[model samples]
Target: MNTPPNPAAGAASRIPEVATDASLVVPVIEEQAVVRREVVETGRVRLTKTVEEHPETLNFTLLHDEVQVERVPVNQFVADGATLPGVRYEGDTMIIPVVREVVVKRMLVVEELHITKHEVPTQESHQVVLRQEMVQVTREPLAPPTPGPPPAS
Candidate 1:
C-alpha cells in the first residue's frame, strides 16, 4: 500500500501556491501566544537586626584641677610703716596676700576620668537575583479545515 504525502515535508514547494489561494480556501492559520513575565515568590530574603547590649571596658585619661594650701611663718623685724608686696611669683607658683602679712601660694593637682568611642565593622551575606530573564513554552495543535461544497468551476 502507498502512503499519502506528508504536508510538512512538501510544504516548501506548495508555499507559493498556498500563498496565492490563502485568501479563498485556507483560513489564515496563525498561532499567537501571549508573552508575559511575572515576579514569583520562589523564596524569601530577610534582613534582621538584632540589638544586644553588652558591657564594654574603656581605658584612657581626662584631667581636672584641685587646690592645696601650705602655711609658713616669717619671724623678722618689720620696718617703720612698710607693707608686704601684693603679689609675687616664684617659679610657676603665685603668692597673694590674705591680709596684712599672711600670704598664700596657689598650686594645682589633677584628677582623671576616661572616655573613648570606637567603630566596629561587620560583614553579612544575603540572597539576591542580580539579573533575571523569563521564558514560557506552549504547544498548540493546528485544527483541520471544515468540509465545504466545491467552489464554482
Candidate 2:
C-alpha cells in the first residue's frame, strides 16, 4: 500500500529525538596530575684561599767548621836546616803552627745560621646535595550530575 507523504514527519525526522529513560547517563569529566622531574641548577659553590703572615721563632742545630787560634811562648833558638812546626793531624782536627819573627794578633771564628725549606701535601673533600620538584597523579570516581526536565513533546 502507498503511504501519504507528511511534511511534519519530515521535520520531526530532521530534529533529534530524546530518550524516554527516567535516569540519564553521561560521561564525567576528570583531571589528573602528571609527575615530571628534571635536573636544574639550584646554587653554586666556590673555594677561596687567603694567606696571612705572623711572627714565629724556630730553633735548630747547625754544624760547621771554624778556625781557632792558640798562642804559646817558647824561648827556643832556631838553627839552620831544622824543621819548623807544620800542619799535623790531631785526632779529627788539623793543627798548624805559624812561626814568625814578630808576635802577631789572632782571632777566633764560629758557625752562624742555616735556612731550609720543606713542602707538604694535603687532601681536601667537599660534598653537595641537590633537590627538585615532581608531579604525582591520582584519580577517583565522582557522583553524576542531577537530571533535568524532559524535552518538550
Candidate 3:
C-alpha cells in the first residue's frame, strides 16, 4: 500500500538539520516551601475581679520588762591605797559601788545600788478585718454570622 507523505512532516524535516557543538542551556525547576501565618478569633474570655473582707481575731503573747532598783548602805573604810570596787553582777542582780573620800584621807564606800530586771508575759486579743480579691473568668464562643438579604441588582 502506497501512502502519500504527510505534508506537515515533510515541511518540518526540510526546515533544518542543524549540527551543534555548543552546550544546550536548559533551566532546572524546583519546588520551594513558603510559610505564612494568619490570626483568627475562636472565642472570647471575660475576667471579673471582686474584693471580699472578713473579720479575724488575733491572739498572741506580749512580753513586758520591769526593773527594780534598791540602795543599800555600806559605810566601810578601805586601806590608804586600796583599789576601789568595780561594778559586778551576781546572777541577775547588778551591784554598783559608790565611793567617797573621808576626812582621814581614806577611801570609804558610801552605798551600793542593786538593780534587777523581770519579764512579764501577757495574752492579748485583737479583732481585725482581712480583705481578699477573687477573680472569675467567663469564656464566650464566637457567634455565627447571620445571613442577610441578597445585594441589590
Please, what are the lDDT tens digits per residue for candidate 1 over residues 1-153? 799998897987766554554575556788988776666444434444444444444444444444444444434434545653345555545555333332333221121112222334444444443433444444454456567895554
Residue-wise C-alpha lDDT for candidate 3, range 1-153, written one tens digit per residue = 999999999999986655587565568999988776667578899999999999999999999999899999999887766788999999999999999987888989999999999999999999999999999999999888578895454
> Quick one: best lDDT, which candidate?
3
* Candidate 2 displacement at residue 144 in angstroms: 41
Q: What is the lDDT ranking, best to worst? A: 3, 2, 1
Q: What's the count of clashing pairs in each model shown?
A: 0, 1, 0
Q: Per-residue alpha-carbon lDDT of model 2 for 52-79, expressed as tens digits? A: 4444444444444454445444444345
lDDT value, candidate 3, whole model: 0.89
Best of the candidates, TM-score: 3
lDDT per model vs. reference? 0.46, 0.50, 0.89
What TM-score do all the candidates reach, one by one? Answer: 0.29, 0.25, 0.67
